[model samples]
Target chain A: MLNKIKRILIELGGIHRFVMRFFRELVRPPYEFKEIIKQCYEVGWKSLPLISLTGFITGIVFTNQSRPSLAEFGATSWLPALISIAIIRALAPLVTALIASGKVGSQIGAELGSMKVTEQIDAMEVSGTNPFKFLVVSRVLATTITIPILSLYTACVGLLGAYLSVNQHESTSFVVYFSQVFEAVSYLDIFSLVLKAVVFGYTIGIVGCYQGYNSSKGTEGVGKAANWAVVMSMFLIFVEEILIVQIIQGMRT
Target chain B: MVNEREHIDQHTKVITVKGVSKSFGDLDVLRGVDLHLFKGENLVVLGRSGTGKSVLIKLISGLLKPDTGTIEVLGEPVDELDEKALQLLRLKIGFSFQSSALYDSMTVRENLEFPLVRNKRHLSRNEINSEVEDVLDAVGLLHTIGQMPSELSGGQRKRIGIARTLILRPEIMLYDEPTAGLDPITCIEINGLINEVQEKYKTSSIIITHDLACAKSVGDRIVMLLDGSFERGGSFDEIFDTNDERVKPFYDYNFII
Candidate 1:
């Protein structure tokens, strides 16, 4: 068992070195600027509608569900503040990530997964292009930039949805609601939310690419890549959330 | 048998593999395999499944490093080149994958544009457009440019894969079973196109395939790989007519009167 564990560790280290070498090659080279732009559109901007719609529903449902519970404590007036902080700092990015895991992550995994199964990645390398930089890095960078933007957009839409939900019960001005929400929010919450989205983006991008990139067997391997990506990325996102929450709680105290 | 590496060098050959061996754990895929790929020559590599044909071509193209051996592609040792150097070397080589391998998300044009986009070979939109159109014309797929790969016929996709490689104007072309899954008619057409590309571009090619028809039709020289090495290398006719003990059975199995 000990020897087996050692072998696994050695293999993982080799993979780490391999991945890092690819990254080093990626940043230095003849960069694919236009392709990167195209990927940004595909991975980031095009995903806006789906992400935004999900965000709206999440915010509306969350506010409506929490309203009765808060009213029991007669804390209903703090609804705007509560919903605002929750949506912007926690729910928006988290929910957006989940949605992206389903949408963008799967798309990336399937796209690359198919490419690998087809020997297209090998073709790229043979043709004198770094597959990692030309394909993986460009897509990953696109996700990093795009996911946060998508998250911010989601937060905005979600806030609007929460406003509608709150207004359904009691009248409230947009200005007063937004002001109260923003007032209750800290710089830390905003920064941390953005930071978390970045991490989520990285997690999704890396896992999706990793699974597809290393997939060896054949046809069903691509499917396995997409499956493993979703599973691994979701786990990482939740774990990071817990870590982020603990750090935030520590900061507050 | 003499090793092919002794006679080849930077000037005489475009690719040379010396004392190359690769293995997966206990299974040795290639053992002391030595071969030479000369410029503007069509070298068809024939082998049964699991004979390491794919692995050999991949090693030449620097996709997988050999466990122990030296690979010189376009005069530079593949193992010694940095990523940037390797990328530059790759630009000079075009590879057609067995499965067409078109980027599923990208349209045919985007798939063809992939390598060009990296090299930025064309400065303006008109130039890129013209080049893409020219290659598409060559492959007889000017109309399929707008369609996604998923929508195309298998033959159409394979043609697009060829067109993608042509966009680079590579010095060497490596094809991994270009006609493996195609119908007979499609196979003949692809074989014809492969020949046309070789004649027109004057680019050295290494075609890896198990299909004997493809080898007979398109290969200038057929190299049969068996038992982890090249068992036979000769002109297509010599390969067909030779009475060499190992060559006779395979030739008889595939060759028609």
Candidate 2:
């Protein structure tokens, strides 16, 4: 148990140092603008289909599940507002983050890990290119920029799905459902959602880069790095979710 | 093998690694390794697996820092220099990895163009295209320009890797186990290319390998790295001519003579 705790501490220190380097390199000149744009396309555009499908399913299922509970209280008409609250304020961000943590996180890990083992990263270094700035900084910056946009997209898709589920029973129009959603959510919810997505994205990027950059022992290490990237980022996302939700709640109260 | 140190004052030293030591946890990879490379010469550091041959060149490239002593590349002390200075120094030194280390996602043209685009910065598109074509043509892989690294065979990838490094036109070349996994014919071709690169680029080089034929074919001076530090140095024939058990086994196992 003591050894495990020590190991965790060491890993955390490694991540802290990596993040510090990212911030240090962040302000430095000769920014890799092209690479960052490419990564944004990878992180943002490539993730859309998965995010859309998952968001739609989440919305449909949650609305169906909550219907019986609201009916018991004879408050079935509150379905739109309640579903909107659940999906926008919490569900959308969490689902988007978990999916990205699996897809983008593992990808960055495996890609960088393969490069690390192959000496491609070292090749870049010897070629006089700043591998960290080109690779890690570009990726992290991409995630930070894209995740908020993805989260917003997820919320929109999820609400549409929820509306479909609602429409099946009540024959409600799209106009009424969207108006209810807009009424239920506030500027605070929007701010919190964006903030949570940014934090989650940063966590995923940093964790993935750290694991893969430090990967060793060849092929086995690549697999391990990918696995750890997903697991660690998901864990941190949950922790951050709770903290951010609490802080927002505190501000509201 | 004779412990022969030849005339040193004739040529200028481009890289000098003195009293360098490195350790990884309990393993002592390099211990008091001292070596030098003269300008425009191919020096082969011959060592069996696990003798820290790769670590030595990595140290020279500033990829890894030595725990003790100093490494001077092109008159700049690698250990003492800051990151920016180290980066500038690294541009002057080209390292050809054993794995070739070509960016797997990039096409051969893009891979060759990468170092140039990053370092040279202000070169016009026409100049970039010209330089990329020149290096690819030199490596005889101009046809593979459009193909990704994954599409190329081992020898092709190795040539492209050398071409990528050559794009920067470095003053020094470090080939780490250049002929490690290739067939005998490919090894000979790679050795020929190493010699060609030296002559064409006018670059001092260090080729680390265990292949006797590679060392014999490409080395101007050969040194055997045994048990971390360099044990002997001289002409390939002179270094392997003795009955020393440490040196004799390598010759016997490789050539079986």
Candidate 3:
């Protein structure tokens, strides 16, 4: 048991070192701008359909689930504001990140892990190209920059779903519903959403890259890397959410 | 048992490994191995499976470090060089992996163009295209330039792998089992290509292989790696006549010449 604990600590240290190296290399020249743009298309644009679907469903389900309790208190009219705040402040960003942790994180991990096993990463290094910059830095930067945008897009789609769900029973106009949705969301809510997106994006990219880059030799190792990338990223996302919420609460006090 | 030091011309030494030893976990792969390569010579290191032939080449390329001793490539100590310095040195030395290691995500043309664009970013698009075309044409795979690595046969992938390295016009080529896992006809073609490449580019090389036919045809000098160090070093004919029991098994069977 002690040995296992020691191993986990050592692995954590390795990941910390890997992240430090990534930041150091991130600022160096030969910035790989083209690769970064390509990764953005891959991580952000390609993920739109899935994010949209999930966001829409989350908004509908959460609204439907909350309707009975609100109706009991004769508060059905407050549905738009309640749904909008919940979706924008937390659900949209969290759901988008979790979905992306499955999609983008696994892809990055599997692709790089296979590269490492096949020696393509070594080939890049031997050919005068920095593999860390070309592979890890580009993907990480793309995720960091794109996830917030994706979350914002998801929040918009989720609100549309919530509006439609509200119209299913009540006779609220489209304009009134949207106005209430906008009125409930403050700059603080938007800022927190964006902050959470950024943290979650960074976590996904780094964990995926670290697992893939340090993948052991063989086919089994590649699978393990992909699996670990998803699991660890999801775990970190929840941890980040708790910390950010606590900090926001502290500021409020 | 053989003194290979006399064969090296000190002034023209391109790579020198002295008393180098390496181990992974408990297994010692290379133990105090020493060797040298002069300019414009095909030096082959022959060893059985997992005898650290690949490890030696990797050490020279600075992909792996040794536990002890030194490897100097083009007069710079590879172990001591920083990442930037090592990357600079790597631009001059091309390594063709045993598995080809072509980027599966990129097409053949893109793979060939990677080194050129990274190393010589100033070249115009047309210049890069022509250079890519020329290297592909040399390897006789110009028509397949647009094809992915998965689309190519084992032989074609190997050729494209070589073309990718040749695009850089490296001064030294380290081939790790270049002709492994190919049909006999493809093997001969690759060996011929190796000879042609050495002559055309005037590139000194270290070809690591267990293929006796490849060693005899492509090697100007052959060294047998046994135990940990080089057991013998000489022309193929000289080593073929050796009475050493360990080296005899390699020549016991008649190989296709």
Candidate 4:
């Protein structure tokens, strides 16, 4: 058990060092603008469908599940306001980040791990190109920029799903439902959601790149990297969510 | 076999590894290995599968560092150079991998253009195009310039790997098992290419291989690495004709023919 703890500590140290190097290299010259734009398209535009579907499903299910409890208090009218706050403040950003942690994180890990195993990374190094700058920095910057946009889109689509669900039972019009939802949401909630998404995105990208870049030597190592990238990024996302929620709550008080 | 250290000019030595040692965990890959490569000479290091031939070449290229000693490539100590300095130094050295290591996402033209794109960033598109075309023509693979690495055969990929390295016009070339998984005919062709590259570019090189034909045909001198150190160093004929117990197994099959 002690050895396992020691190993985990060492791995965390490795990740910390990797992140520091990423920042150090980020400021260097010959920025990979083309690669960064390509990554943005891959991470943002390519992920729209999955993020939209997840947010829609989550919003509908949460409204359906919460209806009985709210109806018990004879408060079905509060459904739009409650669902809006839940989706905007927490669920949308959290779910989008988790999905991206699985999708983009696994891709970065597998791609880089295969490159490392095949010596393509080493070839890049010996060929006078900075693999860390080209691969890691571009992906990280893309995720950081894209994940917030994805979360914001998820929040919008999720509110639409909630509106559709509310109209199914009650006689609320689309404008009335959306007006109630937006009336309940403040600029602080939007700011916090975007902040959380950005942090989650950075964590996912860095973890994936670190795992894949330092992958062990084999096909097995590539699989392990992909697995660990998903696991670690998801774990970090949940942790960040809790901390951000607590911080936001503290600010409210 | 006598060492050929006396014949080489010290000033012409582009790469010099002195008492370099490396180990991973408990396995010692290279131990106290000393080597030197002069200008425009193909020095082939012959060893078995696990005899550190690849490790030695990686050390010369500064891909891996030595644990005990120093390696000087083109006058600067490899281990002491900073990241920027090492990257600049690597621009002068080209390493062709056994697995080709071409970027699978890129086309063959892009692969050949990679090093030039990074190091010679000031060149115009037409200039880069001509350089890529010239290197591809030199490797005789100008026809496959549009294909990706996955679309190429084993021999063609290896040729592209060489073309990618040669496009930079490096001063030193380090080939690690250049013809490892090819057929006999393709292997001979690669060997011929190695010789042609050496003659045309006048580049100093360290070719690591287990293939005797490749060693004999392309090497200006041959060094036998046995049990972690260079056990014999001389001309290909001298090392081949030796009767030393440590070096005999490598040449035994050739002798039976």
How do the candidates rank by lDDT, highest first? Answer: 2, 3, 4, 1
DockQ per candidate: 0.67, 0.95, 0.89, 0.86
Q: Which candidate is the best by TM-score?
A: 2
Q: Model 2 clash pairs? A: none
Candidate 3 lDDT tens digits, A149-169: 999999998988888889887
* lDDT (0 to 1) per candidate: 0.83, 0.92, 0.92, 0.91
Can you write out model 3's per-residue Cα lDDT over B1-257, one digit (the tens) per residue? 22233334547989999999999989999999999998887899998998999999999999999999999999999999999999999999999999999999999989999989999989999999999999898888999989999999999999999999999999999999999999999999999999888878878899999999999888878998998889788888888787888887778753633
Ordering by TM-score: 2, 3, 4, 1
* Candidate 2 lDDT score at position A13: 89
Between 2 and 4, whose DockQ is larger? 2
**Candidate 2 lDDT, B1-257, residue by residue in tens:** 32223422336899999999999989999999999998877889999999999999999999999999899999999999999999999989999999999999998888988999989989999999999999999888899989999899899889999999999999999999999899999998999999888878888899999999999898888999989999899988889889889999999988986
lDDT for A132 in candidate 2 is: 96
lDDT of 4 by residue, A1-253 (tens): 9999999999889988999999998998889999999999999999999999999999889999889999999999999999999999999899999999999999999999999999999999999999999999999999999999999999998888877889998879999998999999998899999999999999989999998999986899999999999999999898899999999988878
**Candidate 2 interface RMS:** 0.5
Q: Candidates' TM-scores? A: 0.89, 0.97, 0.97, 0.96
Better of 1 and 2 by lDDT: 2
**lDDT for each residue of candidate 1 in A91-186, tens digit (9 for 90 to 100):** 988988888877778778878888888777877776656788878888777777788888989999999999998887868888888888899998
How should the candidates be ordered by DockQ, best one leading? 2, 3, 4, 1
Docking class of 1: medium
Interface Cα RMSD, each model: 1.5, 0.5, 0.5, 0.7
